[model samples]
Target: MHPSRRAVLAGTGLLPLALPLLGQAVTPVRAEPAALLRRAIPSSGETLPAIGIGTSRRYEVAPTPEAIAPLREAVLRFVALGGSVIDTAPSYGTAEDVLGLILAEPGLREKLFLCSKVGTPGREAGLAEIERSFKRMNTAMIDLVAVHNLIDTAMNLATLRDLKAGKRIRYVGVTVWRDSQFADLEAVMRRETLDFVQVNYALDDRVAAQRILPLAAERGIAVMVNVPFGRDRLLKAVQGRDLPPWTAEFDCASWPQFFLKYVLAHPAVTCPIPGMAKVAYVEDNLGAARGRMPDAALRARMETYVDAL
Candidate 1:
């Protein structure tokens, strides 16, 4: 029961608003339907916005003033929309350097709940990379440090544990995106003492719901979802399709909202980090954070609807 384009246009009354006056900056209208929703991290009971930004390939840009301005705006606007967590890594080309320049703004740095990872193999290499992240991101103490893709899991987790003990980072965790890695990922979640785990989940990919997500809930590990859009595959699937009217029950206004609300409905999900490179995308994604989330039955309906597409 998707709304027709004309019906949506008529309901929103977008045709009546006048253009901005000259010399007056148009403030982006955000959906303040309610306060931005938050979920607690299981280990420390710290809470974060239900939706966060993932700067993977998106934030990797030439570290020039002009080149980095849009990214800077995205970061600033993300905070303005009540976002806190931002996930990045050294593996993304020039991403740390560009983000470093943006976060050099003292206000912006303080506003973010920053998380980065150690990707190299040995403890020495991991330590060197960790120090480099500290330098590149211009932060003395990071909010979280994870073993990217479970690389050198034991060695890197040991280093993260030491750093956490030393108070260089507030939390320690791990991340992986492939379903093939879920067994190994689940093993670590079971055997190790971790504070968080980032895995792939979206309306299009529900593999995490089977075991990884449930195990995280059982083990008291915070879950950060990556690939919430299925790397744009889901968007392409619904390209010309309108969102179902029942999505409004969860306060969803767009396909992205429909997708994100589905992921967040799982009690184990702390945040879903969808990579956004533009201010408009940030606004849309942040809007998803403010609205009501789907209930179990609604989530099942959403899954069935998407499966049919």
Candidate 2:
């Protein structure tokens, strides 16, 4: 049996709050249908859900029903709860294949703002990888395609632009997995007409905020934040700790929301894609988009609180 939301979080220093937004039986949380927050993609003015799912290590699983049932439920229920963005990549092993199968369910793909990546060097190789991604993800046109980790970025970005011009992809951008590579990412952001840039930013991992985020805002580019929990490092650090009483002011009910809300509260963040394959965890993460986001002062307090942990 899939664990209840509370069961999934039993020992992680947090009690799962009832999620009015999630109605799946796989997740025990219950409440009314509170809408997930929506923010505009600056380049196009199209809106997307403030919270999204990331298919990385969590989704590189066999496509058998026994292996896929939970991940499928998570994706389907995420859309039911109003999530629109789903980011995957060619490097994520069987993730795109599994996602293609799950999203094949009637009306699923249309409801999603599907994003994928390509990392090959030459234009022809990049095009081949993108075509493979399209086949793996079962889509004719991808909403966005980024150059993964800035691999052959100039060539890839040019390729992405050509694809965009031909209407093969809706948007073109780049991604930076590590904070140390911010200089290259920054240079590209300034030089290219990108629609998005995926970067890592949790309360503990604030390097992106120092410049990338603000620059994206300045340049009318959208920001998709990855590794919002410091790639699980923050979760490990907060284990067995108590939720501070003050978190209620902004309606944060769990650790995931607390971490996600911190990222969401930043004006420049278009979405925070936390890697979650469990329905219960998806329910918990979606709640971050429903409540009062912390103001700058509250955000400062949150940083200090988490920093001292």
Which lDDT values do the candidates have, in the order given? 0.87, 0.89
For every model shown, the clashing-pair count is 0, 1
Worst 10 residues of 1 by lDDT: 1-10
- Model 2: worst 10 consecutive residues (lDDT sum): 1-10
Model 2: what TM-score? 0.90
Off by over 4 Å in 2: 1-31
- lDDT string for model 2 (1-309, tens) is 223334533535333465455574333444455688899999889999999999999999998899999999999889988998999999999999999999789989899999999999999999899999999988898999999999999999888988999998999889988999999999999988889999988999998988999999999999999999998988888777767878888977778788999999999999999998988888889988987999999999999998898
Q: On residues 1-309, what C-alpha lDDT tens digit does candidate 1 reach at each position?
A: 554322443455433234679867565552233457899998988889888989899988899999999999988988987898999999988888888999998788888899999999998999999999999988888999999999999999999999999999999999999899999999999999999999999988899999999999999999999999998899899998878778778878788778887888888899999998998788777767765789999999998998998
